[model samples]
Target: MSFQPLIHMFSITVESNTPLTPLDNVNDIAIEFLTHIGYLSKGYTPRSDAEDTSNSIPYVLFMDCFMKHPHKAWTADELAYELKTTKATVYRHINKLKSLDLLEEASAEQSDGKIKKGYKIRFGDLRKAWSFVEANVQMAMQNYRKTVEHFCDLMANDNTD
Candidate 1:
């Protein structure tokens, strides 16, 4: 599927006398980078949509926990405690992430005669994912520029003044 840019149309105010801080610039750049890379659009809510009380909580919580210990594979019980949910819920979320190819089962072993499964974050393959995101961001930015130019031209032609 083609990627769509997530333009953040928010404004930030800063003192004119103060020099631009690295944090400020980095924030702007990160916003733009995330927008162009489609990361920001993943959780967007439609204007006319009703609230979705779906199974998003478990997935989000699982992601948060996974990020904290990307190298370690968490069992259903471990994830449940961290996420404040049930083991079954954690299992459901893990399955969902696995379906998305965001997480993968690293191994399965017998522990005390009981089978234990391990998982790892697949996107931690930073080199490859970063390269892919960079390319996608460039494409999205080009599209955004063209769109902005078209809108500006349209506004200029409109004699609303």
Candidate 2:
């Protein structure tokens, strides 16, 4: 995918003599900050292994929905409909995330005198998760830099001919 620049608005006052130069490297700075804090990373993947034989479509769909609406806890039926999958599939994905400690059962409430389980993302103490992402990203960045250097060396040698 092509890179899309992330921009933020800033307010300035002329009377106060505040510098008003537009941020030229805002995206770079923001990316660095997010990487440092482990918010943006390429480490996220389905919990299931290749040999497990479990389909990953439902897991991917549930992750998409959860990330889009992290604040709201969703029921299995609701998530299944949003993901265009069956309730059984949704439950399987939820179980995977729960195993990873990324999702938590937030509450068990009585609705129409019946107990309903509610699940939410584990946002209360995410330091461990953040650290995991940071370590994975650092490794990925090192590999990416090495590949770029190798490509540049090949191009330079070709140009010398």
Candidate 3:
């Protein structure tokens, strides 16, 4: 099997903005936060053309299933059933979160006593999960910094006159 990076791919947008005060509604905050982090498309247009993203499968899977029950490990099948979508759709969303290092793999015992792979919010807390993401960003930056320094050294040592 090819060695897959722990994070297959990671992308985030950083922008300066005034800190937001907590909204009276959590879903409102969740939508804004998810969009800012690039997990949800900023220009999301659902198939039904519904104005509310809260009803979208990806949003519901993240907000309703994962955020609402942070401590519970969710299997893709369970999420697909809950969201009434296919397992592929559920995995697509889950993989996005995984790329962000915001989820932790877990084992859940099925009703038949078989253990299945599951995923949950890292450390069962969003704040803790974000810290993990931050660490990853820092490490990636450090690697880039090293490469830049090495390239500079190579250029400086070139003796061609």
The most accurate candidate by lDDT is 3
Local distance difference test scores for all models: 0.53, 0.52, 0.84
Candidate 2 lDDT tens digits, 30-109: 33333333333333343445232122443334345554556556778667777566788778667655544556665534
What TM-score, computed on C-alpha atoms, does each candidate reach?
0.40, 0.38, 0.83
RMSD of 3: 3.5
Compute the lDDT for candidate 1.
Answer: 0.53
Writing each residue's lDDT as its tens digit, candidate 3 over 36-153 gives: 8788888886654446788988788888888899999899899989988789988988989988888889987899999999999999999999998898788888988998999999
Could you tally the backbone clashes for each prediction?
0, 0, 0
State model 3's lDDT: 0.84
Tell me how far the alpha carbon of residue 104 in candidate 1 is from the true structure, in angstroms, after superposition: 0.7
Instruction: Return whichever of 2 and 3 wins on TM-score.
Output: 3
lDDT by residue for model 1 (79-145), tens: 6776566777667656655543456676535456665776766655534434543455566579879
Misplaced by over 4 Å in model 3 are 1-8, 48-51, 155-161
Arrange candidates, best TM-score first: 3, 1, 2
What is candidate 1's CA lDDT for residue 141? 74
Where model 2 places Cα greater than 4 Å from the true spot, the runs are: 1-56, 59-62, 108-115, 124-161
